[model samples]
Each structure stands twice: as structure tokens, then as C-alpha cells.
Target chain A: MTVTPDQVLDCSGLACPMPILKTKKAIDSLQIGQILKMTATDPGSKSDIDAWTKKTGHELISYEQAGARYIFYIKKTK
Target chain B: MGETSKRLAIIAAHGSLDAAYPPFILATAAVAMEMECAIFFTFFGLEILKKGYADKLKIAPIGNPAMPVSIPNIVGVLPGMTSMATGMMNGWMRKAHVAKVSELLNIALESGVRFIGCQMTMDVMGYKKEDLIDGIEIGGAASFLEFAGENAITMAF
Candidate 1:
């Protein structure tokens, strides 16, 4: 099954906090129930984003590895 | 997976650039995790709150155990060695895309991390209110300890 995202954020070539920082900023613009697709090369972003989503009450619908990129789809729950 | 602690308090006691990053990074991460955070900068650490001081903060290689290479105490005393070491570390962080100290400070502030400057330290060190950055609350040990007392965790760095 394919889940389409309402928004996409590219965070390649960034490190640790940048990906999480950018994700936090990007998610604020999303409406409730809207899905944000984030792509990053930083391996740490996986757990960082996971932790962020859990804390913020966002839904982490998907975390997939496609080739060299790690992709995350988050839904704003609040 | 239960509700994480909603508050965190940190005491930053060192002034070196290398030492400074941990508190800011942790504060930022805490805020992102929806934790209310406060950072109290005391003594040398208060230098981070002074206007235009973050960029000037340097890691003195002399007697620093974490330096990549150890130099003799006499050689470490030479002029320009601190600057050279600072430059090397800055360049490495830049190449690795680590956020600069100033940038991290801005992020932490914007994320609503409470920035507090120790009043007793400032008075003893002869620092005035205008010497620090805006949005900093001048606080005494009791005030910061109050915040710490209410929080689940208080860490010192």
C-alpha cells in the first residue's frame, strides 16, 4: 500500500539537531491529520524524529529506508 | 512510554566553547521533547550569555584532557595555540554540519528555554545587566534552585 504525504521536507546533508529542528518547524504548518513526509540522510534522525513525534503527540505512520535515504511520515495529532 | 518528565533544569558551570554546547543541545532537545527547560549559567559559564561572547568563547588546549593531541604544558602556554585549537574544532564542527554555538543558542531561546544568569556570579565578577544578552533573567541560587526543586531532573555541566 502507498501512503501519500500532504507535505514533504528534505533534510539531507544535515546533522543531529538540524533534522529535528527543521521537522519541528515544518510540522507546525501542518493541519491536524495532515501527513508530513521527511527525508534525511542522518542516521540519528530516525530515533530523534521518533522521540519527537512521541513527545509532541504526532503519529509516526511510517519510517522506511529507501536506498540511502531514511524517510519518515508523521501525522499531526493535536 | 509513560509521560516523560515535563520539566528539566540544568546548571552550566564551565565557560569553554566545548563545554558550552552540551547544555544548549540538551536544552533544545528537551524543548523539542515538550519539556519545560531552564538553564542557569554561573561563574565562567555566564560568559555564554554576555552579548557577542558566544563566538569569542574558546577551548584552551592547555590541560584539556579531551584534546585530540596532548601538548606539553610549556608548549600549551605559547601564544595563538588556543586560537589555533579553537579554529580547528570550529572547522571540524562546520564540516560535520554541527550547529554553531550561536545558532544553537538562538534555537534554544526561540524554543522557549528559559535562560538565566546567576546574579551572585555577575555581582562578584563585576558584570552588569547590559553586558548580558536580552531575554535573560538575572537570578540567584535560590531562584534557580526553586526551578530545579520543581523539576524531575536537575543536571550540572
Candidate 2:
């Protein structure tokens, strides 16, 4: 299944914590049930975003790998 | 995610450019995870609270273990070594596109992490309230201890 995001953020060439930091800010701008698609070049974002989603009660709808980039689709559940 | 609130308190006791990063990193992480975070800057660490100080922070090679190669203590004592080391470290971080110390501080602050300056240190060090960045809560050890005592995690650096 495919899910479209309400907002998209590109964090290419950024390193650990930057990607996570930007993701947090982007997620906060979203309303409940809105989806955010974030693409990051930092490998650490995969786990960081996952943990953040779990911690904040957001829904990690899906994630996909494309070359060195990791793309995450998250829905704001809370 | 509902129950009791989580809080983290950190003591930033050093002022080196490298030493400054850890507290901001931890506080940013905690705030990102939806936990309340506070950082207390004491001793020389209070310098980081001074306006424009983050941009001027330097890593002194004389005692930093994280240097890729060690220089003799006598050599490190040379007048220009600290700036050289700071330049090298800053270059490396920039070459890798890592976020700067100032950027990290901004992130921590914007994330709702409380920044408390040590009032005792401020008095001893001759730092006036106007000398610090805005929104800093100036307090002594007891104030920090109150936050630390209530938190499950506290770290000193």
C-alpha cells in the first residue's frame, strides 16, 4: 500500500541529530492525523525517527531506502 | 505515552567547544523524545551563556583526549596551539557538515530546554544578568538540585 504525505522535508547531506532535529520540528507543525514525509541522507535517521515516532505516539506508516537516502512517512496520531 | 512526565537535568561544568556540545546534544535528544530538559552551566561553563561566546569557543589541545594524535604537553603549551587545535577541530566538523555548536545551542533552546546559569559562578566570575543571553534563569546549585532531584536522570560534564 502507498501513503501520501501532507508535508515533505528534505534533509539531504545532514548528519546525525540534525536530521532528527529537523524531523521533530517538521512533525510538530503537522496537525493530528496529518502525514509527514521526510527524506534524509543520514543513516541514523532510520532508527532515530522510529524511536521518536514511538515515543511521541506518532504512526510510522512506512519507510523505504533509495540509494543512500532513507525516506520516512509518518502520521501524526496524537 | 501517558503517565508521568520525564525530565532530564544536565550540569555543564566545562566551557571548551567540545565540552559544550554534549549537554546540548543530550538536551536536544531528550526534548525531541518529549521529555523536559534543563541544563545548568557552572564554573567556566557559564561562559557559554555569554552573548556570542558559542561562536568563540575553542578546543584546547593540551588536555583533550579526543585529538586524533597527541602532542607533548610542553608543545601544547605553545601560545598558538589552542587556536590551531580549535581550527582543526572546527575544520573537521565543517568538512563533515556537522552542525555547529551555536546551531546545536539554538536547537536546544528552541526545543524548550531550560537554560540556567549558575548565579554563584556569575557573582564570582563578575557576570551580570545583562551579560548573558536572554531567557536564561540565573540560579545557584540549590535550584539545579531541585530540578535534578525530581528528575530520574542527571548528568555532570
Candidate 3:
């Protein structure tokens, strides 16, 4: 719960591919094991991020919801 | 799980505003998921590749009952209904902060989504290669299928 991110991406208000797209870009800029904290308003990010992490071999460290926002902590694995 | 990156082959056959978003959106998202993606734009779908057309593409409400505002078919057939419906849809997309189709195109191209303008369709439609945005390949059905044949996941929109 106290983990800090290497980068924070604010994808609030963006829809569909934007959230996942921005999350991927942010994760790409990190070295292995670095964490990206991305926040988005798109409700679809839950499934999308899960699928993306599964497919891309990235690690979904954790995620939580705050009101209307979905926040994810993703770690770069490759 | 595999050594080769999976491929996605998409056939985009419709040119309406509603039709245009799927291929690019899916393509970009697929690319983000580390899939090798290509979209073959054919028939009316070519409208999406035309310069300056994506943002201006209109959705005709005349035959679309799914119009968010639910205008009756009679009113939908009226002269201004297409633009009205398109405007309302654009408003909704904007209100939800959806990226414009044009922006999606940029993302697709930048994310390495291969855009294949169907050469046969292009010849039939009389569209020159110069009319499309840069970094696109014009190929025929055989070429598209060649890529699609390589363990690629294919879809249409």
C-alpha cells in the first residue's frame, strides 16, 4: 500500500484505447522492475489492463478504485 | 507464451463514423497489447484513410436506430438528420473524452499498426496513393491474405 511509483500517468477522462495505450507507453519508459501508476476514468480499464498485463508479460502489481477513478500500479517485466 | 508475436489482421469495410472507430481502436489496442496489427481498408472503409476525412466522416441516422438520441426514422430521413446525428454523437464522444478518429489514426500509425489500403479497391474507387496519409502500403487481397494466413487473428469492422 505504501509503494511509490517510478512514473505516474494521469489518463483521467480518456476513453477506450487511450488508457491502456498511455499505460503501455508509460511502462515502456521504465527499466525492468520499475512501477507505473496510472489513473483513468474509463471503467473498461479493469479488464483491459488485466488482459494487457497478461498478454504483454507485464506485472500488475495492484490496483484500486477511488470514486470514479481506476488507479493501477503496473511493473515493467520485459 | 510463444516466440513469435501474434498478428491481428482487420478488414475495415464500412466508412461511416461509427464504422471507422473499431478497426483503428482495436488495432491500436492490439498493438498496445504487443500484437502485430494490420488493417486492410477496403470499399467504403477507404474513407478513413483519406486525408482530412476521418474527423469529418458523418454517421447517417436514416437507417440507424441506435442513434444515441433516438430520433424517429422519419426525422432521421430529413435533410439535416445526418449532420444532426453526427453532431450529437460527436458531442457524446467529446463529453466522454474519447479520442477523435483522427487521433486514433495517429496512434495506430505511431504504434506500428500496419495500414494496408486495398489496392484493388483503390483502383476501383480511383484513389491515388498520394491521397492517403504517409507510411501506408497499398496491397491487394492476396497480399492481405498472405499476412493473415500467418497464424494471425483476423477481424472485420
Winning candidate number (TM-score)? 3
Reference contact recovery of candidate 1: 0.60
Candidate 1 lDDT tens digits, B29-119 = 8877778899999999999999999988998888877777776768879999999889888888888888888999999998899998999
Q: Candidate 3 — which residues are off by over 4 angstroms?
A: B1-5
Give the TM-score (0 to 1) of chain B in model 2: 0.93
The fraction of correct interface contacts reproduced by each prediction comes to: 0.60, 0.68, 0.92
Instruction: Give the Cα error of residue B13 in candidate 1, in Å.
Output: 1.0
Model 3 over residues B1-157: C-alpha lDDT tens digits?
Answer: 5565599999999999999999988999988888899999999998899998889999998877776677888888789888988898899889989899999999999889888899888888899999988989999898789989999999999
- Give stretches of model 2 more than 4 Å off: B1-5
TM-score, predicted candidate 3 vs. hidden true structure: 0.95
Residue pairs of candidate 1 with colliding backbone atoms = none
Please give the range of 10 consecutive residues that has the lowest summed lDDT in model 2 chain A. A15-24
DockQ of 1: 0.71
Interface RMSD of each: 1.2, 1.1, 0.6
Candidate lDDT (C-alpha), each: 0.88, 0.87, 0.90
Instruction: Tell how far residue B97 is off in model 2, in angstroms.
Output: 1.8
Residue B3 displacement (Å), model 2: 7.3
